[model samples]
Every structure is written in C-alpha cells, then in structure tokens.
Target: MDKMDKDEPRWLNEAELNAWKAFNTLIIKLPAALDSQLRNNSGLSHFEYLVLAALSDAPQRALQMSTLAVLANGSLSRLSHVVKRLVKHGYVYRETAPGDGRCTLAVLTDQGYRKLAGSAPGHVEQVRSLVVDALEPEQIEQLRHISQQILHAMDPDLPCPDRR
Candidate 1:
C-alpha cells in the first residue's frame, strides 16, 4: 500500500544476489565444460550425447522421435538434424513405428550401443569431476531438490523422471 515502495525497483538482497550469480555462472559454464570433454574424448557434442543416452535408456533402445525430442529437451528440428548425423555415423536407425504410421521411431544400433559404452566411462568421469565430486552428498541432494523445484516452476506439465 506504500507508494514509495511501489515506485522503487525491487532488488535482490545480498544472499539472493549471491545465489543468482552462482546459478548464472553454472548455467553459462557447465554445458561448455561438458561439451569440451565429450568433443575431445568421444567426438560427440553434449547434445548428441544426451540424445544417445536418452535412447539408450528407452525400452528396446528405441523411442518415438517426438518422444526423444522431449526427453532430450530439444526441438523437433534439432532432433531431426541430430538423428540424421547419428544415422550417418551408423549409431542409430529410424523407421516408422510399427503400430503408428504417422510416428517415427529412432532405434539405437549395436554400433551405437558399443560407441556409447566406450564413451560412457570418460563422460562419467567428466561429470564426476565437474559436478558430483564438487559437492557433498547432502549438497547433491539439495541440488536435486533445487533443480526439480526450478523445473516445476518452468513447466508444471513437464515430467521429471528419476533415473534408475
């Protein structure tokens, strides 16, 4: 009800300011670091790796192309481009879904599975170095909670599946 408060800009307090800065830094830096490691060690970009990993976890190592785009947090166009590259590399194959003529499915081939198996160790190590090992166990739990909270705020309808 105070006119003075309404006219003044709402600014972050010290703790909020610090937290925002740290979060901003992570959003900027973490992807680049992961991308660098994947590119150097496996000749895969982080997005490609994410796409492959999502497929790897799917039942029968296959998923509808649209489902995959959602799982990989990519647009349909981006997924199409990535899938094309993967197909060229013999890592994946695409075909129409058996029961659904309109839906396309992306399947991981043996070669793709083997490639992923080979590259996984290095990628896991990089993840550990960059994230897991950087936090205490409790902090890791906090991070998971915080991340889920943010995701919920961003899109309440989005599913956040727990990895086994």
Candidate 2:
C-alpha cells in the first residue's frame, strides 16, 4: 500500500464546505444566544446553569466534583472556579465524600434548588423557542441522531445526558 503525500490534504468539497459553514455558524451563534438568554433572564451563564442542573438531577442532590465536571462538560479546574462562585452565592457547598476521605463532593443547598427551579422555566422556554420549536418532529429526531454521530466521532466513551 502506498502512503498518501502529506501535501495532498483531504479538503472538503462544495456540499461538505457549505454544510461545514452552516454547522460552524450554528456552533458559534447558538451558545452565545443561549448564554445571552440565560444571563438576561436568570442571572446565570450557560455553564453555571448546566452545573446546577446536573447537581439537581443527581441522587441526594450531590455528586463528586470530578463526576460533576464530566456531567457539566467542564474541566475540573473550571468547575472548581465556578463552584467557588456558586459557593459564594450560597447555591452550593462542598464537603468530603461520606466514605471517601480523599474525594470531594458538591451538594446543592435548598437555596440552590429553589434558584434552579425558578430559573428552569425561563431557560427551558428559551431552549424550546430557539431550537425545539424551530424543528419538525422528524427533524428533531434526525438532529439527535446527527448529534450523537458527531459526539461519538469526537469521543466514543463520552457520556451524553439522558433524554427526557
């Protein structure tokens, strides 16, 4: 088998180029839109909302910081910084895991739960208005499949959140 020359790159063709452009635009714009909505309506960034929501879904409303990072799609360092902010807001607290002295856990306080509950409706409406309501039922399913394929290509072992 002959090796391909390094100078010959596999460039995207016309249709692929157009698709990439559209997808790239979406990737750039969607988060900004969501973050703007979240900031304006809930006083939270998208990542902060993700962290709170992840904790809210956990059993006992707590999770190990490392696990929380994965669920929130953030680095441990980034999670640590955000957690600090949340802690200062009286939204979340940190403690040692019950049986694991070396591991730390993040717990949602009652105030945190109420904040999440209050913020959820507006966030959900923003999501629905921006994405869900813009698609037909079949397109939504196709979007899911397409997203899963892309995610799998990025990291086969990445854990995606369960659909409601």
Candidate 3:
C-alpha cells in the first residue's frame, strides 16, 4: 500500500534519496564551517567573501548591484545591507552607473582586491577539504552532470553559474 501526503510528491528511490540527503547535509554543514573559518580569520562572512571575489574577478572590478545579487544568490535588500558593510569597511565603493543613474555599481577597492587575493587560497583549500578530497574522480564527474541536469530543468534560460 502506498501512502500519499498532500504536500509531498512521489517517494524518492533509494539512490535518489541517498544523493539528496548527502547534498542537503553538505549544503547545511559546509556553509557553516566555511563561515566560521572566514569570520575567525578574516572578520568577514562567507557571503561577503564571495561578493568581493566576484567583483574582483570582474573586468573593471565593478559590477551592477543587481547582477551581483544574482551572482551571489542574494536578494536585493540583502545585497544592499552587505554592500553597506563592505563600503564601511573600506572594501567596496558604490557609484551610480553611467548610463543609468538609478542603477548602482559596486566597485572593489584595491584593499578589497588584496583581501580577496589573500582569502581565496585558504577558501579553496577549505572547499577541497570538504568536497574534492572526499570524492572519487568518477563521483566528481557524476556530481557535475547531475547538478547541471537539475539546474537545466529548473532554469533553462540562465546558464549555470560556473558557465557564466
């Protein structure tokens, strides 16, 4: 006999369930660990590091705040708050975009560039510690393919972040 719950879909198969549980657990745990590392060492959160890194990588070391919000997977309000903090910390400066006075650009300061450059190697090592070192090469490939397939179904128009 099959039991149905109003809010739940079909039961996940064993393999699917295992994968989902693994991903979910990793998602919750990895961020906390990374956030702790960043805060203790750099006086920044993981998301802040991400924002600075993304801007540092941009051509002019500047990006539209809306675009940055998408790249950071943060809401506009949330991004504004973080950007405010970054500006206060002397890491980022904001200015109105040339063509659109309404749109704001976050420009990474030289200090911010130095901060990202300093933090990145440690961050990469942390990522590797949690993920790459734990996975076999074949499993890594499987993860990449599975993630892309899920993302494609969810967002056909927007390419994956890694691709962008």
Candidate 4:
C-alpha cells in the first residue's frame, strides 16, 4: 500500500467519480429536456406540469402547500411562484383547509384536471422514449433501487414514500 498523503484532499475514486459525474450531468440536462418537451407539446413548463401532477394525485385533487412542495420535489418559494401562475391561468385554487383554516391547500380546479389529463399522453410517451425504453426491466428495477440507496445516503431524514 502507498503511504498516506496527509496534505492531499480525499477525492472520489474512479467508479465514484464517474457515477457522480453521470448523475450531475443528468441533473443538469434532464430538466431542460423535459421542459422543452413539455413546452413544445403543451405550452407548459416542467415546473407547471409537476404542480398539476402533485395536486392531481392528492385526495379530492387537493394538497397542503407544504405537502405539495415536498411531493412536487420543489421548494415552498418555488411552489408559491408556480401556484400564482396556475391561479392566474384558472388551473388551480389555493385556500385555507376546511378542517384547519390556517393550513393552506392547493386544490386542482376542473381546468387543472383537464389540462393534466390532456398533457399526460404526450408526457408519458416522452418519458418512455427518453428513459424507460432505454433499459431492460431488470435494469429499470436496479436503477430505482440504486437511486433510492443514493437518495437515502444523501438525505437520511427526508420523508420519501415509495421510491416511485
């Protein structure tokens, strides 16, 4: 074994470095790709689509703002900006929760539901074409598993449900 060099900073090994670079490339490129696809097909940004999708999955198509932020994989400040845009478009409505009036809820209006329903076909096709179709089923499963492992290592306390 080589002598330990105390003055040098520890860095990722080759495998680790390649993995990190690949993931970093994905983080940089995937959003722009998805946004372009969404905008071209639906006149909506990726962020807007995420907001609608989150609300559509909630009970009665409604979710608290804090919960929406987490589920949509966005910060509250970002969600606020998106919500304002959605509100102006008549796609969503925000109000105090019925049980706890202080808690804010973002409810998917009928317009929002329709818009998501319309965009989903194209979105699903884009996802399959870009991601799912590239992998065998086993590889897809491993990807999900590996992604979960890395996510857990990075965020030990975040409340993530099923990795899907």
- List, residue by residue over 1-164, the lDDT tens digit for candidate 4: 34567666788999989989998998898889889999999988998999999899888999999999988888999999999999999999989999898899999999999999999999889889878998898998887887787788889776556765
**Pairwise lDDT winner, candidates 3 and 4:** 4
For candidate 1, write residues 23-92 as lDDT tens digits.
9999999999999998999999888898899999999999999999999999999999999999999999
Over the stretch 110-151, how does candidate 2's per-residue lDDT look in tens digits? 999998999999999988998999999999988988898888
Residue 36, model 4: lDDT of 93
- Report the C-alpha lDDT of model 3 over 1-164, residue by residue, as the tens digit: 34546657779999999989988998899899999888877888999998998898898999999999988878989999999999999999999999999999999999988888888888888889888898998998777887788778878976776642
Q: Let me know the TM-score candidate 3 reaches against the reference structure.
A: 0.87
**Stretches of model 2 off by over 4 angstroms after superposition:** 1-7, 160-164
lDDT of model 4, residue 108: 99
Clashing pairs in 3: none
Candidate 1 root-mean-square deviation in Å: 2.4
Better of 2 and 4 by lDDT: 2
Off by over 4 Å in 1: 2-9, 161-164
Better of 1 and 4 by TM-score: 1
Q: How many clashes show up per model?
A: 0, 0, 0, 0
- At residue 105, candidate 1 shows an lDDT of 97
Q: Which has the greatest TM-score?
A: 2
User: How far out, in Å, is residue 86 in model 1?
Assistant: 0.4
Instruction: Score candidate 4 by TM-score against the native.
Output: 0.89
